[model samples]
Target: MRRLRNDLPYTFRPARPKDWFRPPALWLNRHWLLERKYRVTAIEEQGFERVRELDATGDSMLLAPNHADHADPHLMMEIGRRYELPFHFMAAREVFEVSKRASWALQSMGVFSVDRDGPDVSAIKMALSILAAGKPLVLYPEGEIYHHHERLDPLHEGVASIGMKACGRVSEGRQVWLVPVGMRFLHDPSVEATFRDRLTRLEDRIGWTPKPKMDLDERILRLGQGVLGLKESEFQVNVAAGGIQDRLESLCGQLLEMVEARMGSDGAAGTAPERVRAMRYRIRRRLLDVDHPPGEDERTLLLDDLDRVFAALQAHSYIGDYLLAEPTLDRRAETIMKLEEDLLGFPLYPSARTARILAGEPISISEMLQRGELPRKGGASALTSLLEERLSRLIEVPAGAACSTELVSRQSGETG
Candidate 1:
């Protein structure tokens, strides 16, 4: 250990439920925690006021927020700064480790790692400890930001998993809460001309094309600073208790049952890939729950991943980003080799567990692709010819529509 320099302290601090939403330390937060170059309205007075209510409750909390723009975390930090405690954010490892200032900002903001591609064991352990120690954590259940839409990426069970694990592990399952926070921003001038005016100009400067995520953040932060006009010292906070996860689960279960009850004879044309979707959804949800105000860099890694996924799906192409390789080991072959070690021919994928038992073996990407997960959205039947025409579709199509296009295409030969 080259002695932890002017960097952030590694020693874990004792945390309290309320402490989760405040700025971490004076040094890191003072001028720029959520400071902005532009002035906007609705920062502290409008948007974050709801979160203030959620934080005062005395329990180990899991703050789940809908992801809209990158400003989601930034806005959260603004509230935290006002209250004066930092969240232990679970962020991409590479993004955090890239530079000293970024690392310090993250560490001071209580940052940690959750590698999206690899095992997030360390991050998971870190999160459980924070809750066990009695602190609240923040996570984006959606896992990635998107165009603000009405539908949520069906609440991933991974969030439930973390809650389950933390509940048991934290003080033997005593005080645990999952706090849901929603932000409704009005960039439209009529709703809040004060916020809207600044928002438009900032959006122009940043050139978000449709919308820039950073500008959204700057708008909220500016509203927090300029519109609210805190005396550079005065700050306010509010907190409220939400029902336990069990209570929420019961309610959600009831709702789901009602939905299923009404779903009669909407005959299934195809089975939803429930198993695969559940797994992906869970991993993403878990990553979101365990991390806190992910700094800009970490946010980019995840956003980039989402972009790659969407691009691959839209283009009818296999997804692989040579540029964004995340495995610690340098070579791609090494990453594959590690996975091979675990499955011994089972195509374990991104894991090398149980290597000693099987000895040596070859990795299998085909097996993973066959299972409909390896290449991600590329595996969809409409996206992949093998899964579409050759497998299930042939059985369902009308007989006349099933013939090859070229076989009966001699229009001139049968000019009836």
Candidate 2:
């Protein structure tokens, strides 16, 4: 997981796509950066024709992909290049603040910044405009890159809301489509050795002797428990005794409640991410107010609250049963990688991998609304559930079976 930073004020950055720069930028990303930096050796795409057919009709499209890795945007850009389509991307504001050159490059490639902590009306309007203009807009429903490739985080409802609202804004004959894209990464078998080495390094850092004789899965679970215990102690909460999943939930709740108590605000009832966003928004509103800036002591306290909010969200990202359910090699490696990133403060360099890009059949927003299939009262939530179900099935496509060009209905499990 990328570290969260709260030093910068929230600002909206709109997309300024330069057609001249996108092709070469995409070329460099595909030819060099993805292969060399992200270790992606191959990319296999399925259901791209769905996007092409939608584009042919001049219909507006919103590409909703699971964001399991940081390389997802570049991967999507490569896909757009292949289909001869240009895309507009909605990204977190912190990314644009990384550097001026990065912000410039991202904007040139049609990426815009969004503040996840607050009501970012500007970002929503930008998305509506992009879709209204009959262009492909890419939004990650799973807002954060949690690095859990096999499982998707709870999706934000904003994507569904944007798609539904865009439908009403498009021209008469132009429909709006929500395309659920599933992205999965397969690590090369050679990376198993690297994970073993990483495990040893992590043990050393934690002041424990390397458990070479222990089962790999057991070692990872033990490390995770220890880390969880340390966090509990740090927060002055009694170490909960139970299964990892239960303990994780308990700790996350305690942390969020702690922040809420400090802020004297009842947090919004939802997932941990939602509660964190609420707390952060309240805290930052005071922190960022220039006219009535927080006093030095108040500022210090608010910053601490922000840190705890980040920690709670991070803990929530690690679903304990992920590895136990499947125990695939990829899951084990991802677990180790996440540990190294959290404990060691930097992610391990991933080994060579192949990315499977699966685009599901498009969900026509206008058609659903027109047919009264989607009720306006809770349409966003309903549409979100549908998209989530489709994306979950798409990501579950077996490695050997995902490369086929045939359109496989996620519902029927049949091939044409």
Candidate 3:
């Protein structure tokens, strides 16, 4: 019932079988070939009968799936092409804003943008009309790609809203297929680490040095080349599992457990930025989920988290190197304290909607502890002694530097 007005004219077209041999169509098809060569095993098309039926009978439908990877759209495109159907995808503007070249390529491949932050009633109405008019729509129920598979957040009510609105009025015979796609990549998906250097090359190609203030998402994507690892095979074979989020969650759990084992090993404790990056490669594999939330088109929350986690890991690497080279133990401890304070003060969750925004600068820990960082214990005496034991050997620390024997006094003071 909602209308797109003049903003998006061809957005919601009536049922017409797409012949993809035309200009943008052919180019779009060619664009995904590299993906096919590197990442697809077999692009399977299910419900040929349904596709053919929709084409012949003008039934509008939406293809919905859990968002897992950046390549989710391409996977659908490859499958849609094999079936000879064109399904327009709904994505956030952020995905396309990398540049005109990238945005145009996505649009040409039958992908379109919906304003994620600002409300676009017209675009929503336009999308509804497309489904009502007997065309196909592709949407990622999770709304974003995660580096690793994790539990699905609750499904969004939007897809259902569109379906209910179009029932028979826009759709016929109540025939809509909720095609569940379970794509498993047979490669290491370091997504961030695998692609960091390549992304630097990309920046060089563009002849632009990124401002430190560039959008976090843009910086993450630029380095997202290694976000997923290289293909284990020239042809990626994906086996479709059952379509529910829980089933996918169970499968993801198994994969994550394996990832965790490799990440927490002693071998990865201290190293350079590259070594730390490799450590993150394994850690992210465990911490992040591969399965996307249901009914969302692409959630950036996880990617944002990945960026922070990786950045922290990188900082740790640098600090580790610094500590190893520092001449004195007191200075090293001060540096460590400084880093901790910086992170603690950064917005852990700045926005109301986003639960992980950094809030402010971190407190200096000596100040932090003095300000009662710990609830009950006044800095454990034995623990402090043990730490200072090794640290004393490294530097000419003052005689009373490790003295926390006044814990009894400190605790009483804190209580008051």
Candidate 4:
């Protein structure tokens, strides 16, 4: 739920990947930063034997993990430290813009910047080189952190494309493997009180009297609706008449359509995130064109369009019945964390948590191509689906008791 500013021009930041720096940096992060700041007290890694096995065979590896939290990259560093592997990461360019020191530290840690709003050729080339050199590369196919630990957003096919293309570059007799790494965070049960306090604060911020007597699920839903309504008003959107999910989808769609219209482009056909990316790419290309810079008024409009693009993405993240379907403590906490970020402009670290890092079976790109499973026409999509399915299985939630129908109905009442 990080709010990225799109007004800045992108400069591709390649990976320096200092072998000497990574070990100590990771140790410091694991011992200090993660435990003290991120509240990730423990990290348990599973199935990394597969990673070790692949490393043993001199095979190239592309580790695709489901991105659920901002703490994921640090957790990956912990894994690399535990297994003694050099891991290269493809991170968003916005992260590098935080500060010069942070950017330098990230690059030294083997992290490169990628402009998610556009095609970053530098990042693709770096990834290709990492894989071709028989090294392990980590890329999150989910791309953005939605803070939904139990479920995954759609997997971007670009990861599969990079893996397949890297396969073509590898020396004969060697293979490139795609490993789906699942990350799940388990918060301490005592943190429920902290979550409740967060909900109360959100209610107070929205000018509503705290509802201590209300069930936790209902309070969360009401808070979400309140936040959504505020966003709709801010964007001058009509409060769509429907349940939370429906209203969210409607608002997101309208926002994207607005951006597309302003950019003088036809609507892009894809997920909300995809369309937003396409529009942002077009707008940024124009904005960054120094030789033919946009006029002051036009620049103002373009910046406004960028704001709408981000708003659309934020709305899209909340467009689901994540809590209503099964209100696990993790789900409830994640929902509130997202709300905190959106409302207060920053999220508070709730409590100490354990991150379970499970590496699922690796899918061999070479074997799939040889087996004709990856046809030329839709090979990327096919591979993406397979990767998505694997990651989903690794983090699959057990069927459990859900909220009663009456409660769900009450929670879904019209928010407009």
- Top of the candidates by TM-score: 2
lDDT of 3 by residue, 354-404 (tens): 001001111122323335642224333322232223222312222323212
Model 3 off-target regions past 4 Å?
1-38, 44-51, 149-151, 171-177, 188-416
Candidate 4 at 99: error in angstroms?
Answer: 1.0
Best of the candidates, lDDT: 2
User: Worst ten-residue run, lDDT, model 2?
Assistant: 407-416
Candidate 2 regions exceeding 4 Å error are: 265-268, 404-416
Q: lDDT by residue for model 4 over 16-112, one digit each (tens)?
A: 9787887679767866777777787655567897798888798999999999887899888877866777889999998899899999999999899
lDDT of 1: 0.37
For model 2, residues 128-183, the per-residue Cα lDDT tens digits are 99999999999999888787987888899999999999988999988999999999
lDDT of 1 by residue, 1-416 (tens): 00101112122322123334333443233233322211122331222333344335435666655553334566555445545434556654544655766655566566665654334666778888876666657766555443222223333334445654665565532455555554322232232223344344433433333233444333333322231122111212111134222222333233222323432212321112122222233324433644564566755544433332222121111112221233222222222222222213221122111100000111122334446543443332322222212212222222233111110114214221
Task: Provide TM-scores for the models.
Answer: 0.40, 0.94, 0.40, 0.92
Listed per model in order, the count of residue pairs whose N, CA or C atoms clash below 3 Å is: 13, 0, 41, 0
Off by over 4 Å in 1: 1-40, 44-58, 149-151, 188-310, 313-416
Instruction: Please report, as a residue range, the 10-residue window in candidate 1 with the lowest summed lDDT.
Output: 352-361
Comparing 3 and 4 by TM-score, which wins?
4
